[model samples]
Target: MSQHSSVAGASRPVKEAGFFTKIKNVACLKSSSSSDKGKGGKGKSKSLSNKVSHGFHLVEGQSGHKMEDYHVAEYRKRKNHTLGLFAIFDGHLGDRVPTYLKDNLFNNILEEPNFWKDPEAAIRSAYSSTDKFILDNSMQLGPGGSTAVTAIVIDGKDLWVANIGDSRAVVCERGSANQITVDHEPHAERRRIEKQGGFVTTLPGDVPRVNGQLAVARAFGDQSLKAHLSSEPDVRHVPIDSTIDFVILASDGLWKVSC
Candidate 1:
């Protein structure tokens, strides 16, 4: 099994060469209130009611390149309190964008001055700002793009999830699953794309792609397609009370097969 690293408080960029290439890895984080089960999960108890214990798993796709999916788990100790974070990034073309996100997305989000007072707005601003950074620093990121789904847990009870592109976050309550983020596929968002003067096309044997390039309507990077694509994420708040169980965050590789 590959070992996951901690980027909790480091102020630096993640080296691309250190990107994970394993199919399964395990890491125990000293954080609070969040758990996730990806597709193909086994041995997980169904009755986790109100308790959060997380485990993540990933496998490379048949696509002829390094796995483009990346996940984040970190704990930060502040002067007054501690923060727990979890996230998933699914990249297309190259893993640089996802790698960058794994290292910095939440740090950017939490650094927002209004995060404690207005988390939703803070998340939105952070996402857009992060996307801009990716674009401005494209020389290091390359021409690829990525999707993101992130979760923030406060006091192990209040939960917030944010996403761009098709990667997803789902909550399980008493064995029933409920999606917490929206998938931004080109097909479902055709109208929005057309409104922006962009087109979605389904070429022979391929799903719809924005300008026939990206399958997702929203993403970070893809500098050439930025005007047609969006980086704004859909953010939602869910209270981890008695009725809720755990959450699932996965890339399209798992979601497409599971569904």
Candidate 2:
């Protein structure tokens, strides 16, 4: 089955969220009990439980900085357990913030003693703590921020998705698409920003922005705007069984072009 979901452009009236919470949920693209024919050959059959493929590209924006990274890995926690992790980070103003998250965010969540018990709460806490870490290390990370979307697959059966900022995640089941995350746009977040003692503004031909600088209302880093912005992520869990076929995670660039 094939499914497609278009992420909205920045102009869309969607709430913005980021810090891209990384949580644990497991999903498999194919049923483990079935021997499916490989797409690459007529007779080959591959184990769907462990089959994964990924690729990425880098292109410098007009500002001359190239800062986007995606990650997919099987993370081992205990002697007998492992989790599939996927994430995408879109950097603005600098790359340090996203790079730092790509390296540390998941590790922090995995370290939580109760991660497996209450994954939702664990993810929320991890996102907040991760943002605090960014704020505390502003001196080294610089005054920048990133949008993120992450997925954690546990036991290859449950899929947990989370995000902050405009990045997104989608799941395809029975040839239909379902969005699994909410986009945090400035317009939708204005009230929250104001209540937090920060403000949002919309200039000519520009989408609403927090403090008239950053485009996303939620993100990791951006120390200058951290007080008004949020790093909390919207998270969801879906069981990867016979019905669900695949998942998609991408940055605003792809969303803008197609969503």
Candidate 3:
């Protein structure tokens, strides 16, 4: 029951995190608008250094439930540098987990010990620890889980992305688009899931699902299926230059149709 907010048309320093220490007391940042079920919005922002203008749009899906996807599109000042933070969190079963992520995931990543020296390691560790936190508090977070794709642009010089589940990041350069994150579908990692004592099923008319429940093989929360699920994200880093024009970060709803 949290309302969504956006940092569109302007930039702000990453705010002090609104941490969640108590379950029922959690609240998301207040916003004039909300992306409730069947409702969507669009926004655009520009970086201070490179002037990399980034834009995003969310479209309500056909699903007849409250919006489960959460997102962040903002520019932040950190350590005398401007960082562009973009992400999509696709939730299933409930919204608590994604809402938790929309609030804390980036804060957790930037706070990682070696973020400057090794972003990949820092991101990996953060993802693992974040997922652990979600799983450990599943009773309060609910039985739901979410797939996430986060992109961080540092001082307009580098772009680092990490993802779990089917949410993806696509980088555009010289008029061509290239996907930079892997889609963690159930069939691709069946062996690992099987070894963990879980089974994926593909009915005649349905897509493969983990334990006949979730569609993604890796995600945060889903405490009931944690034994077979992986929260380890595929992390990628790239140096940005003149050729790197833009990047798109979106939840699976934007791409699942083609598959």
Best-matching candidate per lDDT: 3
RMSD of each: 9.4, 10.3, 9.1
lDDT of 2: 0.63
Clashing pairs in 3: none
Which ranges of candidate 2 are over 4 A from the true structure? 1-64, 70-79
What tens digits encode model 2's per-residue C-alpha lDDT throughout 1-259? 0011112110111122221111101122222211111121011112234443222222233333343443333344453555766676777776688788878888888777788898888888898899998999899999888888878877667777889998788665654667888999988988899999988888898778888888888899989888898898999988777666556676665556532
Q: Rate the local accuracy (lDDT) of all candidates.
A: 0.69, 0.63, 0.74
lDDT string, candidate 1, 58-155, tens digits: 55545456666677655555546455577878887777898898888998998999999999999999999999999999999998988888988776
Query: How many clashes (backbone atoms < 3 Å, residues ≥3 apart in a chain or on different chains) does model 2 have?
Result: 18
Candidate 2 vs candidate 3: the lDDT winner is: 3
Candidate 3 ranges beyond 4 A from true positions: 1-38
User: Against the true structure, candidate 3 has what lDDT?
Assistant: 0.74
- Per-residue alpha-carbon lDDT of candidate 3 for residues 52-136, written as tens digits (9 for 90 to 100): 6655555565556667777777778988988888788888888899999989999999999898889899999999999999988
Better of 1 and 2 by lDDT: 1
